[model samples]
Target: MIKIHLSRLLGERRLTQADLARKTGIRPSTIGDYYHELAERINLDHLDLICEVLNCTVSDVLEYIPSHKRKK
Candidate 1:
């Protein structure tokens, strides 16, 4: 599973979904989707924008875990 750590990053940085949307010029709904880890797919451009805004690398935002390693 691909896990998005947007919620954690935002909380650690004291940022809100609206704050990210304003900084990155991404739609608030889209930011909310990522923030909640509800997005099934993500645009690369959007990912780039998010990383830029968060001052983080892609790995800081996303993580891949093998299915066998994931808890049910």
Candidate 2:
């Protein structure tokens, strides 16, 4: 499973979803979806923009955990 750590990163950086959306030139709704992990799939271009605005790598916002590796 893919986990989005956007909320965690934003909280740590004291950034709001609207703030990030403005900085990344992305719509707040779209950013919200990503933040809440409600989107069916993530857009890489949007991810790049987010990383650029946040000044962080993709790993800072996302994590991949295989089913076998998931905690019981």
Candidate 3:
């Protein structure tokens, strides 16, 4: 599964969802959905903005883990 580490990264950086939204110009609700891992899809533009604001790479924000079915 693709995991989003926004919450963890925010906590580690001592940032709040609102802070991220403001800095990234992304909607607060959108940020909340991502933070909670409730998002069904991600916008690349938003992702870019987030990475820029967080000063992080895409890999730092997302991770891929093979599911049981996909694991060899």
TM of each candidate vs. truth: 0.95, 0.91, 0.92
User: Cα lDDT of all candidates, in order?
Assistant: 0.96, 0.90, 0.94
1-72, model 2: which lDDT tens digit per residue? 999999988998999999998898899999999889888788899999988988999998789999988866
Clashing pairs in 2: none
> Top TM-score: which candidate number?
1
**Residue 28, model 3: Cα distance from true site in angstroms:** 0.4
TM-score of 3: 0.92
The 10-residue segment with the lowest total lDDT in model 3: 63-72
**Which ranges of candidate 2 are over 4 A from the true structure?**
none
Best by lDDT: 1
Best of the two (1, 2) by TM-score: 1
Off by over 4 Å in 3: 69-72
Task: Compare candidates 2 and 3 on lDDT and give the better one.
Answer: 3
* Candidate 2 total steric clashes: 0
Question: For every candidate structure, what is the RMSD over all alpha carbons to the true structure, in angstroms?
Answer: 1.0, 1.1, 2.1
